[model samples]
Target: MPDADRQDATLEWVERVATFCVEEWGLTPITGRILGLLMICDPPERSAGQIADAIHASRASLTSNMRLLTTIGLIRKVRVPGDRTAYYRIEDDAWEKVIQRKIAGLGAFGDIAEEGLALIDDANPARTERIRAAQHALTWLRDLAARHPRDATT
Candidate 1:
């Protein structure tokens, strides 16, 4: 594809990613756009101004999302030699971190289910079955993730 067409297609994909993040993860569309751009942008790192321009986002709006993404280990800030402007790039293990966080959340929900089970009365064991099911499902997922961890070489 021609360069301009490629860029247009890339932007469309970025918007799709933004929509997905908004619907599924409760993140702002702009946050997802930043992530998508970082994932596929040529040179792999971009200054804030370039990101803002490409995503059609205001610098002010990008700043907080950038900080949040950086804090959560999805992205990182770098300073090129002889260049004072900061650049951002997606972390090499960003997806793994995302999955790890999801697994941690599952573990937390399992703990909560355990507490609920403890509170249920012995006279009504059926009342605790739902909680037990939820706990079991979470435990199964966590175990599955452990059994088939991502290979670093990939």
Candidate 2:
């Protein structure tokens, strides 16, 4: 197969993955496309303009998404001397960190449950028991995450 055909195939796959991520994972298609492209592209790093062109997104959209990715530590920014433009690249353990953070966010929901439980009177046995059940379940999950580390693959 010719190199051009191969490149087209790869880009098509990336677009498909981006669509999947958007529809199933609640991420913007552009974010998924950026990640997909970076994962497969040679050099492993791309300037914002390159990513924008590859994903067919506006420069402003790429800037916004890149900021979000960088803030979440899924991607990192690189600066080469004498170059004004910033390049973005996926971190080695980006997916692992994403999973870990998601689990941690679940744990943080316990505080909301605790607040709700406090609002209910203890004398109301039925309502209190229901709230207690929810709190217990959430606590169990949080504790479970704490006990078991996030898997590298997911």
Candidate 3:
């Protein structure tokens, strides 16, 4: 394929991935764009200015999104010794961290359910059983996640 055609294809893939992130993962369009660009770009790393230009976002917006991504462990900041700019790239275990956080969220829900059970009337056997079932399932899932190793490649 021609070079221009290849570039077009890459941009198309980036758009598709960005849409997926927004629709399925609840990320903002800009966030999805950043992720998509990072995933496909050469060197697998980009400075904030480059990311902003590619995504058509302001530097401030990129700064905020970068902070969020780093906080969530989805991407990491890379500093070259001689350079003042920081580059960002997706972590090898980014998806694993996502899954782990989701599982941990389920465990938090279980905690809430337990608290609700304590406050609810114990005499209502049917209601109690339903809540218990939900809690049990959450607990089981959390335990199952704990037993498995985090997927290293994402």
Best candidate, TM-score: 1
Task: List model 2 lDDT by residue over 1-154, tens digit each.
Answer: 8999998998898999799879967899899898899888889889998999887899898889889889988899998889998888999998788777766666677657778898988888998888777777777777887777654224
Please report, as a residue range, the 10-residue window in candidate 3 with the lowest summed lDDT: 145-154
TM-scores, in order shown? 0.92, 0.77, 0.82
Per-residue alpha-carbon lDDT of candidate 1 for residues 1-154, written as tens digits (9 for 90 to 100): 9999999999999999899889988999889999999999999999999999999999999999999999999999999999999999999999888878888789789878889988887777777788899999987777777777674212
Ranking by TM-score: 1, 3, 2
Clashing pairs in 2: none
**Model 2 lDDT vs. the true structure?**
0.83
lDDT (Cα atoms) of all candidates against the true structure: 0.90, 0.83, 0.84
- Candidates 1 and 2 compared: the better one by TM-score is 1
Q: List the pairs of residues colliding in candidate 3.
A: none
Clashes of each: 0, 0, 0
Candidate 1: 10-residue stretch with minimal lDDT: 145-154
Distance from true position, residue 78, model 2, in Å?
1.8
Winner by lDDT: 1
What's the CA error at residue 51 for candidate 2, in Å? 1.1
